[model samples]
Target: MKQPLRLHTPRLILRDFQREDSEAVLAYQSKPAYLEHYERPAPTREEARAFVDMLCRWAEEQPRAKYQLAITLDGGQVMGTCGVRKAAPGDTVAEYGCELDPACWKHGYALEASRHLLTWSFETLGVRKLFALTRPQNLSAIRLAEALGFHRVEDGRYELTCP
Candidate 1:
Protein backbone atom coordinates (compact mmCIF):
# COMPACT_ATOMS: atom_id res chain seq x y z
CA MET A 1 0.00 0.00 0.00
CA LYS A 2 1.98 2.99 -1.29
CA GLN A 3 -0.05 5.52 0.61
CA PRO A 4 2.71 6.92 2.88
CA LEU A 5 1.67 4.46 5.61
CA ARG A 6 0.50 6.78 8.34
CA LEU A 7 -1.99 5.58 10.93
CA HIS A 8 -3.60 7.92 13.41
CA THR A 9 -5.29 7.12 16.68
CA PRO A 10 -6.86 9.48 19.19
CA ARG A 11 -3.42 10.28 20.62
CA LEU A 12 -0.81 8.51 18.55
CA ILE A 13 0.63 8.39 15.07
CA LEU A 14 2.11 5.31 13.52
CA ARG A 15 4.63 6.43 10.95
CA ASP A 16 7.58 5.16 8.99
CA PHE A 17 10.95 5.27 10.74
CA GLN A 18 13.55 7.70 9.45
CA ARG A 19 17.32 7.75 9.58
CA GLU A 20 17.34 10.46 12.20
CA ASP A 21 15.21 8.28 14.45
CA SER A 22 18.11 5.96 15.03
CA GLU A 23 19.04 7.90 18.16
CA ALA A 24 15.57 7.66 19.68
CA VAL A 25 15.24 4.02 18.73
CA LEU A 26 18.59 3.30 20.29
CA ALA A 27 17.62 5.09 23.47
CA TYR A 28 14.29 3.40 23.81
CA GLN A 29 15.63 -0.01 22.91
CA SER A 30 18.39 0.39 25.48
CA LYS A 31 16.38 1.64 28.42
CA PRO A 32 17.72 -0.81 31.00
CA ALA A 33 15.22 -3.57 31.76
CA TYR A 34 12.58 -2.10 29.49
CA LEU A 35 13.62 -4.78 27.02
CA GLU A 36 14.04 -7.67 29.43
CA HIS A 37 11.44 -9.78 27.68
CA TYR A 38 12.87 -9.14 24.24
CA GLU A 39 16.41 -9.82 23.19
CA ARG A 40 19.42 -7.90 24.46
CA PRO A 41 17.99 -4.68 23.11
CA ALA A 42 19.56 -2.65 20.30
CA PRO A 43 22.69 -2.22 22.41
CA THR A 44 24.52 0.24 20.16
CA ARG A 45 24.09 3.00 17.66
CA GLU A 46 25.07 0.57 14.95
CA GLU A 47 22.30 -1.84 15.90
CA ALA A 48 19.79 0.96 16.00
CA ARG A 49 20.89 2.10 12.56
CA ALA A 50 20.54 -1.45 11.36
CA PHE A 51 16.97 -1.54 12.62
CA VAL A 52 16.15 1.71 10.85
CA ASP A 53 17.63 0.34 7.67
CA MET A 54 15.51 -2.77 8.01
CA LEU A 55 12.40 -0.68 8.44
CA CYS A 56 13.30 1.40 5.39
CA ARG A 57 13.84 -1.69 3.31
CA TRP A 58 10.54 -3.19 4.38
CA ALA A 59 8.78 0.07 3.61
CA GLU A 60 10.26 -0.03 0.15
CA GLU A 61 9.10 -3.53 -0.65
CA GLN A 62 6.22 -4.04 -3.01
CA PRO A 63 3.09 -5.67 -1.53
CA ARG A 64 4.43 -4.15 1.71
CA ALA A 65 3.53 -7.00 4.01
CA LYS A 66 5.85 -5.75 6.72
CA TYR A 67 5.03 -2.67 8.73
CA GLN A 68 7.35 -1.36 11.43
CA LEU A 69 5.63 1.85 12.30
CA ALA A 70 7.17 4.06 14.98
CA ILE A 71 4.55 4.62 17.60
CA THR A 72 4.47 8.30 18.41
CA LEU A 73 2.49 10.80 20.32
CA ASP A 74 0.00 12.97 18.43
CA GLY A 75 2.71 15.62 18.19
CA GLY A 76 5.20 13.14 16.69
CA GLN A 77 7.37 12.17 19.64
CA VAL A 78 8.04 8.49 19.03
CA MET A 79 7.50 6.28 22.05
CA GLY A 80 7.46 2.78 20.70
CA THR A 81 7.28 0.46 17.70
CA CYS A 82 4.43 -1.85 16.67
CA GLY A 83 3.07 -3.53 13.58
CA VAL A 84 2.57 -6.74 11.60
CA ARG A 85 5.03 -8.48 9.36
CA LYS A 86 5.48 -11.82 7.60
CA ALA A 87 5.57 -14.46 10.30
CA ALA A 88 8.02 -16.83 8.69
CA PRO A 89 9.20 -18.31 5.45
CA GLY A 90 6.30 -19.93 3.54
CA ASP A 91 3.81 -18.64 6.07
CA THR A 92 1.11 -16.44 4.59
CA VAL A 93 0.05 -15.33 8.04
CA ALA A 94 1.48 -12.21 9.64
CA GLU A 95 2.85 -11.68 13.13
CA TYR A 96 1.77 -8.80 15.32
CA GLY A 97 3.99 -7.28 17.96
CA CYS A 98 4.75 -4.09 19.83
CA GLU A 99 7.29 -2.59 22.23
CA LEU A 100 6.55 0.48 24.26
CA ASP A 101 8.88 2.66 26.29
CA PRO A 102 8.46 1.67 29.92
CA ALA A 103 7.96 5.29 30.84
CA CYS A 104 4.89 5.30 28.61
CA TRP A 105 3.59 1.92 29.57
CA LYS A 106 0.05 1.56 30.97
CA HIS A 107 -1.11 4.66 29.13
CA GLY A 108 -2.78 2.35 26.55
CA TYR A 109 -0.43 3.23 23.66
CA ALA A 110 0.28 -0.42 23.01
CA LEU A 111 -3.38 -1.27 22.98
CA GLU A 112 -4.24 1.62 20.68
CA ALA A 113 -1.44 0.98 18.21
CA SER A 114 -2.11 -2.76 18.18
CA ARG A 115 -5.81 -2.33 17.48
CA HIS A 116 -5.07 0.07 14.65
CA LEU A 117 -2.47 -2.28 13.21
CA LEU A 118 -4.90 -5.20 13.28
CA THR A 119 -7.64 -3.15 11.68
CA TRP A 120 -5.37 -1.86 8.93
CA SER A 121 -4.02 -5.31 8.33
CA PHE A 122 -7.46 -6.81 7.81
CA GLU A 123 -9.32 -3.94 6.23
CA THR A 124 -6.60 -2.58 3.98
CA LEU A 125 -4.06 -5.31 3.47
CA GLY A 126 -6.65 -8.08 3.13
CA VAL A 127 -4.92 -10.13 5.82
CA ARG A 128 -7.20 -12.94 6.95
CA LYS A 129 -5.31 -14.19 9.95
CA LEU A 130 -2.69 -12.84 12.30
CA PHE A 131 -0.78 -14.31 15.21
CA ALA A 132 1.08 -12.93 18.18
CA LEU A 133 3.72 -14.83 20.10
CA THR A 134 4.99 -13.71 23.43
CA ARG A 135 6.75 -15.30 26.35
CA PRO A 136 4.30 -16.66 28.88
CA GLN A 137 5.88 -14.28 31.36
CA ASN A 138 5.06 -11.26 29.22
CA LEU A 139 1.79 -10.56 30.90
CA SER A 140 1.22 -7.22 29.18
CA ALA A 141 1.45 -8.67 25.69
CA ILE A 142 -0.78 -11.57 26.61
CA ARG A 143 -3.29 -9.23 28.16
CA LEU A 144 -3.21 -6.86 25.21
CA ALA A 145 -3.75 -9.67 22.75
CA GLU A 146 -6.68 -10.99 24.71
CA ALA A 147 -8.14 -7.54 25.26
CA LEU A 148 -7.93 -6.93 21.52
CA GLY A 149 -9.92 -10.10 20.87
CA PHE A 150 -7.06 -12.39 19.95
CA HIS A 151 -7.74 -15.94 21.10
CA ARG A 152 -5.29 -18.21 22.82
CA VAL A 153 -4.50 -20.80 20.18
CA GLU A 154 -1.87 -22.43 22.38
CA ASP A 155 0.59 -21.71 25.14
CA GLY A 156 2.16 -18.29 24.51
CA ARG A 157 0.47 -18.03 21.12
CA TYR A 158 -2.53 -15.90 20.30
CA GLU A 159 -4.39 -15.71 17.01
CA LEU A 160 -6.73 -13.12 15.58
CA THR A 161 -9.11 -13.95 12.77
CA CYS A 162 -10.54 -11.23 10.63
CA PRO A 163 -13.77 -11.29 8.73
Candidate 2:
Protein backbone atom coordinates (compact mmCIF):
# COMPACT_ATOMS: atom_id res chain seq x y z
CA MET A 1 0.00 0.00 0.00
CA LYS A 2 1.11 3.53 -0.68
CA GLN A 3 1.75 5.62 2.42
CA PRO A 4 1.26 9.32 2.83
CA LEU A 5 4.28 11.43 3.67
CA ARG A 6 2.92 12.00 7.14
CA LEU A 7 -0.12 11.48 9.29
CA HIS A 8 -1.38 13.73 12.08
CA THR A 9 -3.45 13.12 15.18
CA PRO A 10 -4.56 15.27 18.07
CA ARG A 11 -1.18 14.96 19.79
CA LEU A 12 1.16 13.13 17.43
CA ILE A 13 2.70 13.52 14.00
CA LEU A 14 3.71 10.26 12.33
CA ARG A 15 6.41 10.86 9.77
CA ASP A 16 9.14 9.12 7.88
CA PHE A 17 12.29 8.76 9.89
CA GLN A 18 14.88 11.45 9.26
CA ARG A 19 18.65 11.22 9.28
CA GLU A 20 18.62 13.07 12.58
CA ASP A 21 16.41 10.44 14.14
CA SER A 22 19.30 8.04 14.51
CA GLU A 23 20.41 9.40 17.88
CA ALA A 24 16.98 9.03 19.44
CA VAL A 25 16.55 5.56 17.99
CA LEU A 26 19.94 4.53 19.25
CA ALA A 27 19.33 5.96 22.70
CA TYR A 28 16.19 3.96 23.34
CA GLN A 29 17.63 0.86 21.68
CA SER A 30 20.63 1.00 23.97
CA LYS A 31 18.44 0.28 26.97
CA PRO A 32 19.18 -3.28 28.07
CA ALA A 33 15.57 -4.05 28.83
CA TYR A 34 14.44 -2.94 25.41
CA LEU A 35 17.30 -4.68 23.63
CA GLU A 36 16.34 -8.02 25.09
CA HIS A 37 13.07 -8.08 23.17
CA TYR A 38 14.65 -8.20 19.73
CA GLU A 39 15.49 -11.49 18.03
CA ARG A 40 19.02 -10.36 17.24
CA PRO A 41 21.65 -8.89 19.49
CA ALA A 42 21.64 -5.18 20.19
CA PRO A 43 22.95 -3.20 17.24
CA THR A 44 26.32 -1.57 17.24
CA ARG A 45 26.52 2.11 16.31
CA GLU A 46 27.34 1.28 12.69
CA GLU A 47 24.62 -1.30 12.52
CA ALA A 48 22.10 1.18 13.84
CA ARG A 49 22.97 3.54 11.01
CA ALA A 50 22.33 0.78 8.51
CA PHE A 51 19.07 -0.08 10.20
CA VAL A 52 17.86 3.52 10.01
CA ASP A 53 18.88 3.61 6.38
CA MET A 54 16.77 0.53 5.74
CA LEU A 55 13.82 2.12 7.51
CA CYS A 56 14.09 5.22 5.34
CA ARG A 57 14.36 3.13 2.21
CA TRP A 58 11.28 1.15 3.11
CA ALA A 59 9.37 4.31 3.89
CA GLU A 60 10.22 5.72 0.48
CA GLU A 61 8.97 2.78 -1.50
CA GLN A 62 5.54 2.95 -3.07
CA PRO A 63 3.30 -0.07 -2.67
CA ARG A 64 5.76 -1.31 -0.12
CA ALA A 65 5.45 -4.62 1.67
CA LYS A 66 6.23 -2.79 4.90
CA TYR A 67 6.08 0.74 6.22
CA GLN A 68 7.39 2.17 9.46
CA LEU A 69 7.00 5.67 10.85
CA ALA A 70 8.90 7.58 13.44
CA ILE A 71 6.40 8.44 16.13
CA THR A 72 6.84 12.04 17.16
CA LEU A 73 4.99 14.76 19.01
CA ASP A 74 3.48 17.71 17.22
CA GLY A 75 6.57 19.58 18.35
CA GLY A 76 8.78 17.01 16.54
CA GLN A 77 10.41 15.16 19.43
CA VAL A 78 11.08 11.57 18.47
CA MET A 79 9.21 9.04 20.62
CA GLY A 80 9.77 5.73 18.85
CA THR A 81 8.79 3.63 15.84
CA CYS A 82 5.47 2.06 14.87
CA GLY A 83 4.57 0.21 11.71
CA VAL A 84 2.55 -2.39 9.81
CA ARG A 85 3.62 -4.87 7.21
CA LYS A 86 2.20 -7.64 5.07
CA ALA A 87 2.61 -10.80 7.14
CA ALA A 88 2.99 -12.90 4.03
CA PRO A 89 2.01 -12.83 0.39
CA GLY A 90 -1.76 -12.63 0.00
CA ASP A 91 -2.23 -13.55 3.64
CA THR A 92 -5.02 -11.01 4.31
CA VAL A 93 -3.54 -10.54 7.76
CA ALA A 94 -1.02 -7.77 8.35
CA GLU A 95 1.34 -7.58 11.30
CA TYR A 96 1.58 -4.51 13.53
CA GLY A 97 4.21 -3.40 16.03
CA CYS A 98 5.15 -0.36 18.05
CA GLU A 99 8.01 0.74 20.26
CA LEU A 100 8.07 3.79 22.48
CA ASP A 101 11.01 5.44 24.16
CA PRO A 102 11.31 4.38 27.78
CA ALA A 103 11.03 8.01 28.86
CA CYS A 104 7.72 8.30 27.05
CA TRP A 105 6.18 5.07 28.30
CA LYS A 106 2.80 5.19 30.14
CA HIS A 107 1.64 8.29 28.28
CA GLY A 108 -0.86 6.41 26.07
CA TYR A 109 1.20 7.35 23.02
CA ALA A 110 1.47 3.73 21.88
CA LEU A 111 -2.28 3.33 21.86
CA GLU A 112 -2.81 6.62 20.11
CA ALA A 113 -0.21 5.79 17.50
CA SER A 114 -1.68 2.34 17.08
CA ARG A 115 -5.17 3.65 16.52
CA HIS A 116 -3.97 5.75 13.64
CA LEU A 117 -1.98 2.86 12.24
CA LEU A 118 -4.89 0.43 12.34
CA THR A 119 -7.16 2.96 10.70
CA TRP A 120 -4.66 3.57 7.93
CA SER A 121 -4.10 -0.10 7.41
CA PHE A 122 -7.77 -0.95 7.24
CA GLU A 123 -9.01 2.08 5.34
CA THR A 124 -6.10 3.28 3.29
CA LEU A 125 -4.44 -0.06 2.73
CA GLY A 126 -7.66 -2.01 2.25
CA VAL A 127 -6.68 -4.36 4.99
CA ARG A 128 -9.39 -6.32 6.77
CA LYS A 129 -7.39 -7.88 9.58
CA LEU A 130 -4.39 -7.02 11.65
CA PHE A 131 -2.34 -9.05 14.12
CA ALA A 132 0.40 -8.63 16.66
CA LEU A 133 2.84 -10.95 18.40
CA THR A 134 4.48 -10.24 21.71
CA ARG A 135 6.15 -11.97 24.55
CA PRO A 136 3.57 -13.49 26.84
CA GLN A 137 4.97 -11.60 29.79
CA ASN A 138 4.60 -8.19 28.18
CA LEU A 139 1.51 -7.06 30.03
CA SER A 140 1.57 -3.54 28.66
CA ALA A 141 1.59 -4.73 25.04
CA ILE A 142 -1.16 -7.22 25.78
CA ARG A 143 -3.25 -4.48 27.39
CA LEU A 144 -2.62 -2.12 24.51
CA ALA A 145 -3.65 -4.73 21.95
CA GLU A 146 -6.79 -5.51 23.93
CA ALA A 147 -7.54 -1.82 24.34
CA LEU A 148 -7.34 -1.48 20.56
CA GLY A 149 -9.93 -4.20 20.08
CA PHE A 150 -7.73 -7.19 19.54
CA HIS A 151 -8.58 -10.63 20.91
CA ARG A 152 -6.30 -13.42 21.85
CA VAL A 153 -5.92 -15.63 18.80
CA GLU A 154 -3.31 -17.96 20.23
CA ASP A 155 -0.46 -18.02 22.70
CA GLY A 156 1.21 -14.60 22.60
CA ARG A 157 -0.74 -13.69 19.48
CA TYR A 158 -3.67 -11.32 19.07
CA GLU A 159 -5.90 -10.41 16.17
CA LEU A 160 -8.08 -7.41 15.30
CA THR A 161 -10.54 -7.35 12.49
CA CYS A 162 -11.94 -4.31 10.79
CA PRO A 163 -15.32 -3.10 11.92
Clashing pairs in 1: none
Candidate 1 stretches greater than 4 Å from native: 1-3, 39-42, 87-92
Q: Best by lDDT, which number?
A: 1
* Residue-level lDDT tens digits of model 1 in 1-163: 4666788999889998877788888888888757778766447899889988899878877756688899989846678899888854334588888898888999998999988888988887777788889899888889999999999989999998895
| Collision count for each candidate, in order | 0, 0
Q: How far out, in Å, is residue 67 in model 1?
A: 1.2
lDDT by residue (tens digit), candidate 2, 1-91? 4544688889999888877788888888888777666667767888778878898877766546676888999847788989888854345
* Residue pairs clashing, model 2: none
Could you tell me which 10 consecutive residues in candidate 2 have the lowest summed lDDT? 84-93
Report model 1's TM-score to 2 decimal places: 0.90
TM-score of every candidate: 0.90, 0.88
